[model samples]
Target: MNAQYKSCIEAVYRCIEACNVCYHACLKEEHMSNMSKCIELDRECAEICTLALHSMQRSSTFAIQILSLCAEICDACGTECKSHNHQHCQDCAQACFRCAEECRKLIS
Candidate 1:
């Protein structure tokens, strides 16, 4: 992979980890009802990031398209996580935003 792809892959992996962590943490929150959006977004973000990583790894023709979608999902997840006060949420948000940026770089 090229240096750009290498960085994007790293960011995608980190985003996946963060999203997974946030998903579990949100489930454990006392007000589970309030964390529903965060949980949903976290799961979506992780799934998309995983797909993006795989597509990029294989150098698929649709890799750029997948990255575009992944960036959108990451942004949504980041926004949701940022609205929460938990440290896990904050960390996930940061990772999501960074991943989105990296994905955008690959697409553009």
Candidate 2:
């Protein structure tokens, strides 16, 4: 993988960690009912990021395509995360935004 792709892979890993943390954090929030959507999206984003990371690691020919989907999910997850007051959600949003931007470089 090129440096850009490598960097995106790292971002994907970080995003996975962030999403996992954010999901669990959301579950523990006082207003758990308000965070269900965020939790769902967080899990989806994490799964997509994991797939992208694996695809990149294997140097799959479709890695770029996978990253494209990952980027979209990351952006969506970030937007959802930003709706919360929790620090973990904000942090996860930032991570997702970074990962989304990095993933864009591969296809752009």
Candidate 3:
């Protein structure tokens, strides 16, 4: 609930929304085969972000490690999304990057 957590929580929530949007967008793409991995990672990243947010909210002792995992998942999702040329993918990648950075800050 501190200001230090505000940025990370906001970034995580934003990433969750972005990942959901990107996952749906990938599903609708005609190049479904190419987007399969991206969609999977998007779901995973969103789930991790949610877990990290809840852990932080509860001020859990394991929050730092959870955030670290969140950061790794965000990085992976961002990389996967960025491989595609779609605007949604690009936006999602950016959101993931922001979330990763914020999460790392909390850990450090």
Candidate 4:
């Protein structure tokens, strides 16, 4: 893979880690019901981010497609997390937004 693509993959991995941490934290909150959607999105985002990262790392022909899906998932996750008032949700939203931007760049 190219250096630029490797950098994007790293960013996605970082976002995946952040999202996973936030997902667990959100699940432990007292008002878990309020964060249900955020938690779900976090899990989905993390999985897609991992897939995209790996695909890019290997320079798969379908890397662009994976990046597109990652972007979409990140957008959804960011929106869902932003709907909550919790700190974890807010952090997750920021991470998701960043990941989405990175993935978007890879797509283009």
Q: Estimate the TM-score for candidate 1.
A: 0.96
lDDT value, residue 99 of candidate 3: 99
lDDT order, best first, reads: 1, 3, 2, 4
Model 4: CA > 4 A from native: none
lDDT of 4 by residue, 1-108 (tens): 668796687778878987999899998999888877888889999998999888887888998999999999999999988888877778888888888898888778
lDDT of 3 by residue, 16-57 (tens): 999999999999999889999999999999999999989888
**What lDDT would each prediction earn against the true structure?**
0.95, 0.93, 0.94, 0.86
Error of 1 at 59 (Å): 0.9
Better of 2 and 4 by lDDT: 2
Q: Specify the poorest-scoring 10-residue window by lDDT in model 2.
A: 1-10
For every candidate, C-alpha RMSD to the true structure in Å: 0.8, 1.0, 0.8, 1.2
Best by lDDT: 1
Q: What is the model-wide C-alpha lDDT for candidate 1?
A: 0.95
Give candidate 2's error at residue 47 in angstroms.
Answer: 0.2
Worst ten-residue run, lDDT, model 4? 1-10
Q: Which regions of candidate 2 deviate over 4 angstroms?
A: 1-3
lDDT (C-alpha) at residue 26 in model 1: 91
Put down candidate 2 lDDT per residue, 1-108, tens digits, no spaces. Answer: 545577888899999999999999998999999998899999999999999999998888998899999999999999999988799999999999999999999889
TM-score of each: 0.96, 0.96, 0.96, 0.92
Candidate 3, clashing residue pairs? none
